[model samples]
Target: MDTDTPAVSAADSRVRRPPTADERTTLVAFLGWHRETLRVKCAGLTAAQLADRVLSPSGLSLLGLVRHAAETERFWFRTVMAGEPFEGLYAGDGAFDVARADERTVDEAWAAWRREVEFGERFVDEARDLDVAGDEPGEGPVSLRWVLMHLLEEYARHNGHADLLRERLDGVVGL
Candidate 1:
């Protein structure tokens, strides 16, 4: 294990179960659950372990997934939902290209991911309703509801990838 890698345990995080009532509450809870699932999937991995592309012929790695998730959160929440001026974290290239096993890279990716998540939570909380819309570059207006749903789908898909990556890395399973 790299000395710079922080020890993490799956049990340290809690994912909220989807609520039975209220559209907004249920959506938020589900999103939170998916987010936590990603975190849990990534728990207890060293920086080098995270960067390993266990599945050959594909560039997918746990660290890359983290970076990709961060970029996804930033794109939907800050750029699409809030209409904030956006710039890609990895600049000209995609998130996966910037993924590295080094401590600095890992730290930056996690910080960016957490920051985007925090901003997303605040943006969703302050929205007047799920009907609140933002303009997409080519798709015209998109509602908060659509964004939330899209985010849920995005996280769920990536969590599946993370699951596979985690299993390949350490034989850990179930999240």
Candidate 2:
């Protein structure tokens, strides 16, 4: 069994952002940082370790976070921005359900996350500008800037949770 099928290297070797850049560049850089942070946190773990409820009573495994992030990516990019049909990868909170998680499940979650992330990048790149609008829940015509900020916050918040989860899993902390 692949005990550590890491998707990224240590946080120290992160993707460096330009010292100064435009709003879009900054937003994308920050989002990329947070995404890499998650990958760093989840590194060096077996399938069982990735799926372990180290915090028990809460099924927020590293694998689960990847799954949910994929879901979020699809929601914001495909459903809201492109008016594409939307469906959750897992039923209800099944994204957080890792009781049956194994190597295959871990691979699937990672692949889905990577796909959504790539699609989101492509969508953003093709947009006319940050001012490009989309229909947000209960809000009419929210701009791409708003979506970027929302996703930034979402990933930041989840990354914090990931910090805790990783620490509990093996006392590995800081990122």
Candidate 3:
């Protein structure tokens, strides 16, 4: 667990930048920040490192976080926003847990996560400043503000995991 390498190497351009004013810039900045945070967490690790399950006995890994966060964005934005059905990438109902990893499977997992993040970005860009209420059945009405706040919460929780996992993988810690 001592890789001790920066996730964003000297050449990778996905490092964090300054955030903008919330009143003007929307929550996309915040969301993007966390997404990049996870990407950085997965940095400098091999495919085996990315898919390592030692963080949890049930197969949670940095790669799992990447996949989970992406699907989460899609679940909230696509299913909740566009009313689409859920056919998740890494989850199955009534299953014991997510699958044990293979190289090809983990690669697909990473791709699915990234694709959903991109899709969510497009959704947010189109919905900028357009407040809409959630119409998902059995859920209370929610504004875009609520959605954004929830996303921030989600990202924050995962970022904590990213911090610990990154630290465990390497000695690097702090923001």
Q: How do the residues 16-61 of candidate 1 rate in per-residue lDDT, one tens digit apiece?
A: 5665769999999999988877777877777788888888878899
Candidate 3 per-residue C-alpha lDDT over 1-175 given as tens digits, one digit per residue, 9 for 90 to 100: 2222233362344545455566425466777777776766676666666666666654566766777776788787788876688767654531213445555655666666777777877777777464865655557666666777788898889889877766776666764
Q: Once model 1 is optimally superposed onto the true structure by TM-score, how far is the C-alpha of residue 78 displaced, in angstroms? A: 1.2
Deviation from truth (RMSD, Å), model 2: 2.3
Ranking by TM-score: 1, 2, 3
Lowest-scoring 10 consecutive residues by lDDT in candidate 3? 1-10
Stretches of candidate 1 above 4 Å error?
Answer: 1-7
lDDT of each: 0.82, 0.82, 0.65
Q: How well does candidate 3 score on lDDT at residue 107? A: 60
Per-residue lDDT, model 3, residue 42, is: 70
Model 3 score (lDDT): 0.65
**Candidate 2 regions with alpha-carbon error over 4 angstroms:** 1-13
The TM-scores, one per candidate, come to 0.92, 0.91, 0.78
Kindly indicate the candidate among 1 and 3 with the higher TM-score: 1
